[model samples]
Target: MTGWRAIIPLNLGRERKTRLAGRLSPSERERLVEAMALHVIDQLRSAGSVAEIYVLSPAEPGFPGTQWLKDTRCGLNQELAHVLGGERMLVIHADLPLLDANEVEALLREADKVGAAIAPDRATTGTNALALRDPGAFIPAFGEGSFARHRTLLPDAAIVVRPGLQIDVDKPEDLELALKSGATSIACPI
Candidate 1:
């Protein structure tokens, strides 16, 4: 079988919050974020199970073997459609360095049965990852309370709740937790 495909929307715009604001300088923080993204991409490639891997950004990411698609005005929803290509789509964030490829594979396998599945943050207030059998299922409402918004969008869609896979770096404390938890590889370039 061709299996499913994964698309990582790399929010490379400079406005992201500093995960290590107090511990690292501004330049170091930016570099750290970039490294984390590369690490996740590398792990995905190592799995060699997913059919395709694309990174969505305004500019082409320097990483090799990744399909770089220019982000549209609609943000993630548009990018999800471009990469999904009618097959099952696993929409993940590049900031999640500690993701288990097997978990991703499981999500893909499960997607074969369900219409959609989403991985929410620890707080269960925000969405960290989303999976859909149809690319059109993506409706971006990413913000403080996006978890509810997405659930509303896919009222009939199945939900696959995973904890570790849902951890995404956002605040400075999150970065420290990732590093201290030995999932630091998820913070560095793979």
Candidate 2:
């Protein structure tokens, strides 16, 4: 597998996990976000193929080996587009509670075969992890039904399905799924 940089975009403002409001308080939600982001950075650091890890956000998440970039807050796609010019990179969501080094390595391995690869959510509608040969190869569309949208845009990209990469905690059910999937305590309890 080729070496690649990982970019994680975190929106700590109103844009962060609004769907979890019914289950977790504002502070609890923030803690969860930070925890998951840290977990992702840690996993990337441990991954053999990961060269650098970058956290793009309004404020620093302060993980030990990550480079923090100031997020323009313009939107996920635009913010990502600003940082990705022509380098090979992996864009991972911050809410992936079950993410680990193995999953990242698997994704990169698949990318080596297909130039680009994406791990869609369990429902196969949302994109949780995306890898590209060139950052600008395709614009990232990461919201509702984004998996299908991304596939449409990058028809040649391989589809990698790993449980850890597929399970990003967004709703209460998602959190439960992560917990059942052996996700450790990265954040405090709701």
Whole-model lDDT per candidate: 0.69, 0.84
TM-score of each: 0.84, 0.92
TM-score of 1: 0.84
**Alpha-carbon RMSD, each predicted model:** 2.7, 1.8
Can you write out model 1's per-residue Cα lDDT over 152-179, one digit (the tens) per residue?
9877655656644666778767776677
Q: Which ranges of candidate 2 are over 4 A from the true structure?
A: 13-15, 187-189
Candidate 2 structure quality by residue, lDDT tens digits, 1-190: 3469889888755546778889888888888888888788888889999998988888776778888888877888878877876666999998888887999988888877777899999999999999987766367888889999999988889999998899989898999888888888544555
Each candidate structure's count of clashing pairs: 3, 0
Best by lDDT: 2
Q: Cα miss at 176, model 1 (Å)?
A: 1.8
> In angstroms, what RMSD does candidate 2 have relative to the true structure?
1.8
